[model samples]
Target chain A: MAHVSIPSYWKTLPQRYCLIGMKCKNCGTINFPAREICISCKQKSEFEPKKLSGRGKIYSYTVIAAGSAPPEFSEQEKLAGSFPVAIVELEEGLRICAQITDYEEEDLKIEAEVEAVFRKIYEEDKVIRYGLKFRPVKKRKSLP
Target chain B: MTLQKVAIIGVGQTRFGNIIDKKAEELFAEAFLEAVNDVDKGIDISEIQEVYIGNSGVGGGQLGNFSSLMTDYVGLTGASALRIENACASSGFAMRAAILAVSSGVCDVALAGGEEKMNDTPRNRVRYWLGISGDMEWERLSGMTFAGVFALMAIRHMHEYGTKREHLAMVSVKNHKNGASNPKAHLQRETTLERALASPMIAYPLTLFDCCPISDGASAVIVCKADLAKKYTDTPVYVAGHGGSTDRLSVFQRDDVTSINSSVVAAKRAYKMASVKPEDIDVAEVHDCFTIAEIIAYEDLGFCPKGKGGKLLEEGQTEIGGKIPVNPSGGLKSKGHPVGATGTGQIYEIVNQLRGSVEKKNRQVSGAEIGLTHNTGGSGGTTVVHILKR
Candidate 1:
């Protein structure tokens, strides 16, 4: 029932699942989801597929109320209520937008350290779409 | 060979709100007729050699070949017609096309207008239609709506510039107050700062009152060669300048999220063409789809320094009685945003403001000779700026 087709979803899997980025060989700039041309250098130079480290911090965020959830996300909203979405600034210096998962409202702050985790994005046409979502980094307890 | 100059001989717009009684054709006809009647000298509809209609086909009703349908409805069936689609800036680009058609000597007279019927669509479908304007694969898939996108900007802006929540509410208060005087406004009632701040949150940092409502409306304007403008109307508003630009579609792709680079580039081109600075503009109709948008427009249009937009509003500088009167027609915030119709609707307001013909005396900017209209498609991905002078 999603607008995206099966092949379209499949095409995005590498970038979606692994946070694969395209680094412009000419200018040393990285583009999220990969691009043939570098945005910074405006060159059609060769691009190398680079895996982005999942560690990042929140740049900006918003809590989508239940009423404003898009139809495609209705099922998710019904199950989870309002959810927080954020622009996560990766350690590689590229900013990517994704839903922030497994965090309390008070904990969602700008510059909050987060790490990408694979999770279910949504299900449509009887196929579940899985992608990366950022969550607050959990601190490990000391072994006493 | 010198290119011809373009002038707007007439402009018209229906009361912007829910009008289920009339279909799209009827709405376009009504605005078209009003524009024709507004011309100082009579003009035959058949003389219109070219027509450019702006429409997003939001409801998916009569999407294909819509330009011909509108012209045929208005009895200009045989004339050349085309539809321009740039999301909310459709009509602004349509007007730009009409100016080019007249200025290039391709046609002596042309029609540019836009119409949309958004109120009748189902809520879920409405969300779907509006969502596609943004990056569907990434932004929408992450549950970002138009409001959510802007909300993100607002949060970042506040973080960097110390803009208070009150600064955002003030936009709604000022625009709603102005809309109260205009008869055509959809939300004609005014709201206080307290109420705007307290309104339910659609997206954080942006309450319900920050967003423009979905409405059904249409608007039209007639453009002709400036040399031949005297034959049609003595008060013809000259199309002093026009500029348009496009940026990266997704917000994440841009280097700066606080400002819209397209608006800045478009406004610069327009100012250069007109040989006029922002201070020369007596009145303006900038895209105020949300409060933060208008604030960003102020900076992008050079009305104030970057990050000073919030202070500009807080100082009452953009009010009707202030140094630069903006959105005196209530803007999209109060006047209503019917998608495709919004761009030309801004033009309609500026034309009337330039002519000193605004129905409400209090809403009129005094001695308004030069005016500007800033129309943006989607979240500033595309923008068109036009300068008008009497």
Candidate 2:
């Protein structure tokens, strides 16, 4: 069995280890973290599940000193040192926000290209919290 | 029908910083005295018909009945008073209330004031209350704070258009440099671009320096109807246009982060109502709760092109001599943001600019005939734009 698990509630585990967004079938607007209604067209019940293109550009990022971040993120980072926070521009024109893992905070450059990776942020008493975070593209390690 | 011309006959404020020991009423009286004193002649409290004040929940204090208390301190024996609040845009709304009251013939003279005694409360609680106006279900659950929301918008601005941190830092450097000149500003110390960028991060892409300090202070402005204006002062600043609008609470709801539509709409309404454009204005005091907000205001207020705000800051285009000098009174970024008092503070700055008394030598824009103020409530949900002419 894989160490990773998506509980019975999900329709399917994310594909390509990617974060999911919804596109308004009515207005063709893609939204991250999903929304039930379309703000532009004022149409609801028209959204369809959509997979996002993980490749994106860095908008802006900053390193928060450990104590300043939300109490939850601060504790989880005790296990993962110096997470990279970024706003990424998807190929589809949607801006997806996520934290970056597997890269040095100082090494990350603004507008640099990157892809997504689904990872566990923090797990509590008995429940596990799973979410998507981004990392810089490895120049030598080609995308699968 | 055109709105009745409203004029600011007097403006005043108390020292802005960490004010905790004082009560709201005491602060209001202090600011009220300053404004009445600035009237050139004198304003009797009895002559002032009404009062509008803004105060965000300080220590969860109930201020619904706070206005009536103001009359006692100001010695307005029988004046009708009311508290007006719209989140951080409280004082801005207070100014609007006073303007409308006089324009509607309800009163010839009115007082608008704002105060926040916030140092007595904890920072976390302040953050909690600040988040009250938005769609808390989605935003708070998602951990999107006011700074986080603006920070995300800053990130989006960078991604879609290439706005740089160095450019954003210019807002802090400029405002702080301006704030340093105003003895009344909360953070009267100048900040360099390097120091601003190196400050500890609050939200991603937003350094502590980029964010305005949590300040405690008060501000007041006395407005009079057109016919009775001469009774107050010879040089009165007329209110040409007043407009307000609201945007979707969620940042996701807005089409573009590069431009603030609410600010645009409010400014549009104000300009059309005033028969003026951004070009005709001499100076402005736009909301700069964060450096990014100021950058966006440059575009939203029509001072510069979209994606050109950062460039404008770098070239000193927003200084006293440029296309339009903004935040000459240090703005929210440097002057201090006492949430409720912030909006009225902008009015104070604009009136001072129109009067040519905005203390700083380098910041004094000479021969200024028109000035404007842009105030936003809770993460752009509500915004008011006012144009004042001398």
Candidate 3:
């Protein structure tokens, strides 16, 4: 498969890096990745651009075990050593899939609280590509 | 206009496995020749009016246009032919097209088939092409492979419905048992649940046994007008009803990952058109690319209520002699899934079961009058359902 060009990669920067989504004015349905039309109600209503809270619970998750990774993810798989990936439900009730990082193995359970953070996805042609990844939210400790 | 009724007169399939000697076209020729020979009264090469070949176009860059190349190789030259690509459900939609083509009075006889040669290519290339089925920019680019996509589904279904890993293993055990009886099956040996659970994990909760093998094979079916079907065979399988539906490409976008909406929509239309309820189906072949997929299919196809698929499998309901036997031809898991060829292969199995031609009596559903097949595209994006009556 051919790699996407710089222009194409830059086009979806809002969705790729920031947690931006489209909320339909007509039905209040949040469309992730910000689509032109609302999926629910089938109305060509005005879509309100909303920056998500980037907070959600893991709806489901999987660990990309070694030897079965795709060619593109070989580097990440090598560096991460079987990292956890998740499909998360945002505070707005919209679902998005992203890799989970900066977490221990025990935190990879279902419904684990996570928050989005921008990180390096990969690099090609001497250009470093970045994208959002979810990390387990830290539990608060009482001050002494 | 209402769809025309179609009947299947002949069906053929090559052994589903890694065949180093054959190419896609040769595999297709093998299945086509056998299908032509299977017709009760014998069908001439000239009788085939149109050909609908389903291929993921996995290697079309190297092999060129598959339909044209395959048709030319099989002496189908000058027959209006085109390739249909809907990821894994390619041939299932091709079956629907052939049914409509005959039902609408366009052609008297048509051939619907599919072929895939995934094994001959390098493993990396095969994986790359398989990833093409998902949203390339979002899913694949983000490091979510096909296995990872389904793993996510399995995780959610388990959480929401209390489905256990043992319930998932039961599907593999049952399918492999059925596939062991099928001589043409790729993996012709039954595996124990203990073995399945202990297999190497490809994706969490989905082990090697849970995934269908990558295979190279072909399948073909000869279908014609329902009324004229008797001219070709004494016991023809009528394609009573057909339906197709589509959903979002990526699984994350869908509200629910536990159930496939396309399968639900397609099954409803097929049931209504066939005038038979889910209980009426005596046998079925469903897309079980992954064990989790088969479990979800049981619910989506209405064999059991939502969230009850795991329990149904636990009760041994999907076994060969159980209520509404599924994937008797070993399914995509034990039988091989050559992507494009899978749907037609399912149709072939149903046609054989309905005609009482399956040599293995143990795997056969006795006195089966109504049968159904459900074929799905990548991650439930597209689904095609067909109902057949003996």
Candidate 4:
């Protein structure tokens, strides 16, 4: 794998580390991965940098099986037999795709509440890429 | 202003499979020659005014300027030539460009073709190369392969519409059954439902059989002004209407991942221009790059209601003798998707079926006067729909 230059990975650190997205002042739309323009109202409106709650539900999910895994993930796949990736719908009404980590295969399900956590996404060219991955939120038990 | 009408005078394609030894340019020239020969009255190579070649992988294959390379090999170097790259829909857009070139009077005759040699790369390397079309940073960097992207969509479809793995398997069984008679298909052997379902899973819901094979092939078509079409062929397939649309590159950004919006828009435009509704289409060749894609296409193209594509498949309505026979060429499933060549390859099947030239009569849709070809790039980034009629 080729080395991703410092600026390439560094610039997206905000979105990767904090789940920061642009909130449209005019239409109150939350654009994930932070776009300049809002898709909802088509207005060239001012934006507010909003830090997402990092809590969301699994909108969709897929577990990549062995033998057909992508080459880049070969290393990660070796550690975790099959990995699940999901599209998480954030509390702010914006959807973002992220790898579902820190959970077992049985724990993953559609609409399961999940919270973002910092995790190592991949290691390439001696540089370890870190990003947010969603894990199923633990259910609280009531005292009987 | 009204665009002048255009018609497909001739069409040809290489047998869809892994041509390990053949180069891209050679395959292109072979298909070009076949197209030129297929013209009923025969067309002079020099008279072809414009050339559009859809090539996506020739850069990896080492022949970068594939358009000029093919033009030179086919003895049409002087004719204006360019390459179109929209991933899998390259040739579909190339065909659109050629049709526009002829219809707009920019050129009386134009040649549209596509070629790709994907099998030359190692299997592991092929996965890396195929992933380039998607959002590399977010999707690929996160370790999602191409099939994984479709798997995401399939998962949503299943969650939303109750589309089962069995429904997906039925798609493969039907396509493979159709493919068995197609001599040029990559896997010409029919597979049973048991075999399709038992195939190992690549992604949770999509099994090995749900995806198309990486193939190496080429396809070419000769198009001319509709008014002058008769001079070349008595039974020319008219380019009744064509439409193309684009959507957000990343599937997550879209409002609905279950449906490809671009196809819905493109199909509406094509249907409007053709002055026909979806029911009028007697035959179709849809982009079945993945089984789920075919299901979504049925809904997007107005073949069935939204969330009901799975039911449509279960009813066997998409079969050869059913209501609207889709992917009569076995689609990209068994026909083999040679990325660049797939678009024009779809056109080749539609043209042959419309002309009553399909060698295997059983594969041909009887009394088929109208046909449609739906080609998509990436998941839903670009979609081009064409309506053709005899």
Chain A TM-scores for all candidates read 0.94, 0.75, 0.91, 0.89
- Scanning candidate 4 chain B in windows of ten residues, the lowest lDDT window is B57-66
Cα lDDT tens digits for candidate 1, B101-182: 9899999999999999998898889988897887778888888888999888898889988877899999999999999998
Clashes of 4: 0
Q: How should the candidates be ordered by DockQ, best one leading? A: 1, 3, 4, 2
Task: Give the chain B TM-score achieved by candidate 1.
Answer: 0.99
The lDDT values for all models are 0.91, 0.78, 0.89, 0.89
Put down candidate 4 lDDT per residue, B305-350, tens digits, no spaces. 9999999998999998999999988999999999999999999999
- The prediction achieving the highest TM-score against the true structure is 1
Q: TM-score of every model?
A: 0.98, 0.82, 0.97, 0.97
The residue-by-residue lDDT of candidate 3 on B216-245, one tens digit each, is 899999999888888898989998888999
Candidate 4 structure, TM-score to reference: 0.97
Candidate 2 structure quality by residue, lDDT tens digits, B1-390: 455678899998988898767777787788888998999977776888988898877557756677777777778858888888788888898999899999988888998989888787776556556656655433443334567778877877887778898988889998998899888889999988899999887777888888898888999999998767888798788999989988876665556766778899999999998999999999989899989999999889888888888888878988878878899988888889888888878888888888888777677888899999999987888899999998
Supply the TM-score for candidate 1: 0.98
Tell me what TM-score chain A of model 2 achieves: 0.75
The predicted structure with the larger TM-score, 1 or 4, is: 1
Clashing pairs in 3: B4-B103
**Residue A130 CA error for candidate 4 (Å)?**
0.5
lDDT of 2 by residue, A1-144 (tens): 111243431432342245567778988887665667765566785777787778887665545445454444445547554455655677878665566678865546667888877777555444555656778886796679
Complex DockQ per candidate: 0.78, 0.18, 0.76, 0.70
The ten-residue window of minimal lDDT in model 1 chain B covers B247-256
* For every candidate, C-alpha RMSD to the true structure in Å: 1.1, 5.5, 1.4, 1.5
Best by lDDT: 1
